[model samples]
Target: MSITEQIRSLEELASVDAELKILEDQLNQERSTLDALRGSLQKLEDKLKTDRAHIAALDKTRSDLVAEVRQMNQQIEHSREKMNRSRNEREANAAQRELEELRKLLRDREEEIGKLTTEAEGARQGIEGTEGEASKISAELGSQEGDISSRLSEVESQKAKRVTDREVAAKKLPPVLYRRYEQIRSKRGTGIAQTSDGTCKACNMALPPQLFHRLRREPLLDQCPSCNRIIYFVSPAAAAQPVKEG
Candidate 1:
């Protein structure tokens, strides 16, 4: 094939390959973002569940405290009723002293109920705080989910467009030039390089004067001795020629 045709073919192939690489990198990034978002969502869900369980336990504790307090009140009422029926009927000083002691016992139990009520109030406040925190976390997780979905969709669309562009550029090359370019790219990571001022751009090696002069004649495809890549001279006028069949 003509040198210019070879360069154009290789250039188009390189463009397509570069675009495909970028698309793959972007796809990987998008997938990573999705995975991280899902993980955060799962963590938030677990935290919410744990918070709810703790709140439920706190509620049960408060309820039990209230029931105990009610039971204490009932006992105090019964004791008072008994003391009234006795009506100072006990003539012994010891009996009067015993009734006073029972009254003191009821007073102590009342104080205990008051302490329990305060503790229950504290527990209720804690439950409220946990619920608020859980709600905030849930809302954050929802927003992340939506954001990740939107980002992934955008990446997918961009990737599709890049792939289409790559395909179109690949089709511009002749079949043989296209196949050779693909083979070299797969094996060496680059299929073509420019030879300018006696230097091979691919390897940055100064070509021998004999080789550099030979390339100027546009005889045939030339592989750089140093880098093993097809070398072409870039010229705007020569770039439009059709590739000659070998």
Candidate 2:
């Protein structure tokens, strides 16, 4: 193929490569988001489990306290009956003291039960809040997964077609030229750059008059000295028209 035709083919391949890179980057970003969502959900689930365990422990403590309080109440009732049966003042006073001590123990146990009950309520609330958050995240993750899957399929299809096009374009060029194009693309992300009005479009550097003249006369691919990119000259008519930036 002629150098001009070869340049055109390289340009086509470069366009395809650019598109593929964009699709791949997008796919990676979506996958990363999916991973982050899953990680967050796992952490929330772990926290919920811990909170439930804490509540269970608190419930057991409360139950033990209740049983102790009941036992204390029974002891106080027996002490009261003993005081009623006491004949002497000294024995009656001793029975009263015993009853007071039993009552005190019962009060202390009840207070502990109240505290434990409050703590268990707090833990239950925490679990509810965490479950709500997890549900929200799970719904969002589901939607995102669907979108990513569809987008991935579309991107893969387009990428496959572009790969085929790139292969066909590469085959048209001489092996040496094709290799040079690949090397430049690897470094600069673009191999072929169009020039307009004596300026290298890729680097926006002004080309020397002599080099521009050579580019027009030589009919072979030329590299820009400043940027080392493959450069092509456009006709004045094309140059006069506004060119869109890539």
Candidate 3:
């Protein structure tokens, strides 16, 4: 291939490769997003499970407290009946003291039941709130599933087309030049670098005056001394042409 044809083929291949890279990057980002969404869903599910377990524990506590309160009530009633049956002053005094102690015990048990009831209510509310949030997240995830899948399919199709184009473009160059381009690309991610105003755009380094003159005079491929990337010069008119993909 002539020097100009070689540069054109390389440029076309580079363009396609760049596009393919973009598509691949997009695919990676989309996959990450899907993974993140699923992770969030898993977290919500775990939290919901924990909340349910907490509520169950609270309910058991409340039931135990209620049973204790009922027992205390029955004991206080029996103490009251014993006080009514007292005959002498000493017996009445003793019965009165006994009744006071039983009432105090009953009051303490009722207080505990009240506290547990409140705690159980709070736990119930927590379960409701968590369930609502999980539902919202589930809906949002469901909505994104179709869109992500469609975008992934489209990106894969585009990447396949670009790969084909790149193969065709690579075939146009001589074997030695193609191998050299691949070597540079492997190291630097881009093999071809355009030059502007005596500067290598890739490395942003100044080209030697002699080298720049040679590049302009000879129809040959040249490498940047600083970065070793294939260099090409574009005239003002040529640069103005609309860039097209091969």
Candidate 4:
């Protein structure tokens, strides 16, 4: 391959590498979103469990109150029958007062039960809301997971193709040039750069006339002074040619 052809190959590699980077970023973003959603779902589940437990405890308390009130009523009824049989007027008066006090206690217990039932109902509503939020998070997480998988697959395939192309291009270059390209690629994430209209395409630096002329002749492989990237002159003709033609 001519010097211009090599430069063109490098440019193509850069383009592919750029695309690969974008896909990788997108894949990473999707994975991040999936992780965040998973955390949210976990929190929602924990909240639901706590709410359900609280509601269950309230229900148990309410049932106990109902049983206690029923026992109090039975005691009052037995006391009234006993008072009627004995004909002890003062004792009957004491029994009646005790029964009245028990009735008041029952009324208070009933009121507490009503309040507790309301609280339990509120807890149930909270649990339902948490469950619904968890479901939504699960669905969103599933979608993100699928997108990440698909994008990762595409990135891997594209990366493989880029590797193959890079290897092919390396074969066409001199050993010294290839080595220099590798060094620059490691440092700057790019192996080669084009010299365009007296400027380095990699760093957009205007080159000295002497350096520009040196690259135009394709002497030894050149590195850009500003960017440290391997610089080569791009032939207008080579740029116009298609990859298949090359």
- Candidate of highest lDDT: 2
Task: Provide the lDDT at 155 for model 1.
Answer: 71
**lDDT (Cα, tens digit) per residue for candidate 4, span 1-246:** 666566656666666656666666776776677678888988898888888888889999999999998998898787777667656878888878877887889799989989998999888888888888889888888777777678778777876777777577657666776677677777787766666466776677888889898777763357778878877776655433221100
TM-scores of all predicted structures: 0.49, 0.69, 0.72, 0.59
Q: Report lDDT (CA) for all predictions.
A: 0.66, 0.82, 0.80, 0.74
Residue 194 Cα positional deviation in candidate 3, in Å, after optimal superposition: 0.9
Ranked candidates (lDDT, high to low): 2, 3, 4, 1
Weakest 10 consecutive residues, lDDT, candidate 3?
237-246
lDDT of 2: 0.82
What's the lDDT for residue 37 in model 2?
Answer: 96
- Candidate 4 error regions (>4 Å): 1-9, 29-43, 57-115, 136-159, 164-183, 235-246
The order of the candidates by TM-score, greatest first, is 3, 2, 4, 1
Worst 10 residues of 4 by lDDT: 237-246
What is the Cα-based lDDT of residue 92 in candidate 1? 42
Return the lDDT, model 3, position 4.
86
Candidate 4 CA-lDDT value = 0.74
Best by TM-score: 3
What C-alpha RMSD separates each model from the true structure? 8.8, 4.5, 4.5, 6.3
